[model samples]
Target: MSESARTHTRQRDDASGATTPAVPGTASFDRLGLPDGILRVLREQGVTVPFPIQAAALPHALAGRDVLGRGRTGSGKTLAFGLGMLARTAGRRAQPKEPLTLVLVPTRELAQQVGEALTPYAEALRLRLATVVGGVSVGRQAAVLRDGAEVVVATPGRLHDLVERRSCRLGRVRIVVLDEADQMCDMGFLPQVTEILDQVRPDGQRMLFSATLDHDVDQLVRDYLRDPAVHSVDPSSGAVSAVDHHVLVVHGPDRYAVTTEIAARDGRVVLFLDTKHGVDQLTRHLRAAGVAAAALHSGKSQPQRTRTLAQFKEGQVTALVATNVAARGLHVDDLDLVVNVDPATDPKDYLHRAGRTARAGRSGTVVTLVLSGQRRETSQVLADAGVTPKVAKVRSGEAELTRITGAKAPSGNPLDGGPVAPRPKNHNAPFRGLGSTKAAQGGSAGRPSRRTTEARKLAEAQRAARVRRGG
Candidate 1:
């Protein structure tokens, strides 16, 4: 066979026997056996065209068959499963504490995203939806469940906690979808996943979607899914054609400076580190260097994380510093740049971090910084992931950095002539002062800083104005 023919043959052979090929040309939601309400919702969302994964998986899923879908991030896997689950349980009424459909995700962020994505469709169908995740009020979640939520999107840990507390039950679940199954396994949620699956109705339909079907995922498939129609739309590595990858070799001491320059660039940028502490420290360093940046990690409360993400998305913060927790299934639109401040420990992590950009056919650039001590390991990681990026030995404020990442030197002044304060552990506490805890407690030599004095004067003026107007 010719090379092209051989590639086609492999693509045709990747799926299981029960799989059906997707038709070429743009496919519409109406042609895919979806109901009128869902079709209307899709139109309202301006989704007139369906992506490859949705086209391949929707047919079997809508036909009430088990489906194992494999697709990269940002490939419309959420809609692929979400639409099917909603269509299957459209007319069903959920009893208190027992949902008709359950969508399991790997992280709190993903749960929130998926719920937001599906809410309009559920509302159009007159279906009540609830999101259950940890790091928030369980009482609120239980109240929603008690009031009867037909569709529940949740993270496994919080769902399991609710199940154990008898606040939520799985006995009436008619359809279950596991989105991002590979990530759930990576986060050590397989046992909890299996436990939760065991409680669902035995005859319910199941759909599992993942970027890759490794050994652990295969085991879950064997144990839970029955005669599933498998579909693989894109490669698991998430190396989209629109993204350009580069490796920058830098000196140890210059690493932070290079990263700061990149983050200070014009467009929105997401910089990834290996640890939560690294994320916090880098965020502080970037803010101190006059870049508007925010940190997101597991240690942050749910509300703080949400606020940080909103800030980044709304352009209030130009760069977001995060750990691997932000990698999978977190979508931010129009993000053109991603930087790996610390080289990912493995290829999978690298790909997930890079997937944050170049999404949905938008052009993006991903740059990895490698110091002398990490060159060999970084090279091996890239090779294993089948990515061959251009390597350059660069320094801070060099032409190479500018040419590759559009990084320019930043003005030394802080963004607003004020420091970014460290995130408080208690979400209810007000931010007392900028950047310094000691200053917040008491200024140096018992004298307030100029900014604090100005803030007090402004507050007093506002209060006096309000009092005079009222009394």
Candidate 2:
């Protein structure tokens, strides 16, 4: 191992005077031998210092060695793998339908996010990038691949579909990244992931990063990786010290009302439910109770999901109700609260759900609502996950709720007179130099302008033509 590859550890003395491994420290990215261009981009992003995971993984990865990385969410794993891939493949040109690098994530949201995070750096490196995922126009994604993207960020299933359609070819891939490998397995996409990996060049360097490694992930590593360098920054079962965990025991009848009270609190909050039906139902309930909220799940179309997440991030919507699809690899900035409307059944699920908050050294709180029947199971789950939360028995209108979660009574009024309407399907029309006809005619009624109607029709016609072209 190189001096930079050595894990920097300090000894922590306990009450018995015995030492334990302390959290490791990381050297700067420049010290890891990244190119000046990549370093310049990091500096522009205000990322002068490297996170522990990045420091540990970057050295091996930049050297074209296979790496197995383990780090908790918000540990900067994205940049750890992303920067290495970009730097290694710098100045490489991709052939049509054959990418030079591939990043496989588990969800469409993650694919989009990974793309967004890497785009600026890729631009700085003068590399072309594309994102491929389901729940959107596959033809559009195929067109991007056909135009030749040097790097492709994708989910396994959608990439498989494109490959089958002859829109993508992996023969020239030089480096591959399997981010959130454990979550991909949990979502039952390992088979598709395996199939996709089978197509990549045998000499391509592989990097696999996950919070936990079970039998399935182990199998993938054994089958594909060659003498990988393994680096783990944090324990898989451990909780973030910055997060304050709490279990609120509510009566079954009062759960919905109490949840509404919590959602109405100030600031952006994420509420997790066990099922998509529950997510949609709670979103409606929260909106009805006068909280601006949105739902994110597989049931939502890609456009709808993208819009909802954008609204939440931009503070146009303050609450997001979602299922496990949002549990891993979804990075929201300064989000301080996460509510588990339904307690997670698995220990890893609990950790990932709570991982949404208390990220990047920020203080945050995670509250799990446990009903009477779920108390025992919830306790076991927490214990197994190495979390010892403060258990409280609470109900609606209690001062404890306000003290813990900043819960406040909602002003039972619609948000801007109910939900915001979807944007017009046609967004490419040339702007007319005239004001709305309603305002021009001295009518105060809120209605679509004639120009708006025309734009929509034109957009719809264009969409129909594209569909006919299979693009």
Instruction: Determine which window of 10 residues in candidate 2 has minimal summed lDDT.
Output: 426-435
lDDT of 2 at 230: 73
With a 3 Å backbone cut-off (N, CA, C), the pairs that clash in candidate 2 are: none
Residue-level lDDT of model 2, residues 222-331, one tens digit each, is 78887676777667665466689999997755665677778899999999988887788677756766889999999999999899999999998899999998898678
lDDT of 1 by residue, 1-471 (tens): 222111110112233544444333226788777778999988877998777777777777888878888776677889988998898888889999999999999999999999999998898889999999999999999999999999999999999999988999999997999988988998899999999899999999999987666776877888888877777765554455467989998765566567778887888899998878778877776777778899999999999999999898899999899999899867999998889888887888888788888776577888998877788999898777767788899877788899888897766556545754332222212222112333456646457779999999999999999999994
Candidate 1: where is the Cα deviation over 4 Å? 1-26, 415-471
Instruction: State model 2's lDDT.
Output: 0.82
Ten-residue region with minimum lDDT total, candidate 1 = 2-11
Q: Which of the numbered candidates is closest to the native, going by highest TM-score? A: 1
lDDT of each: 0.80, 0.82
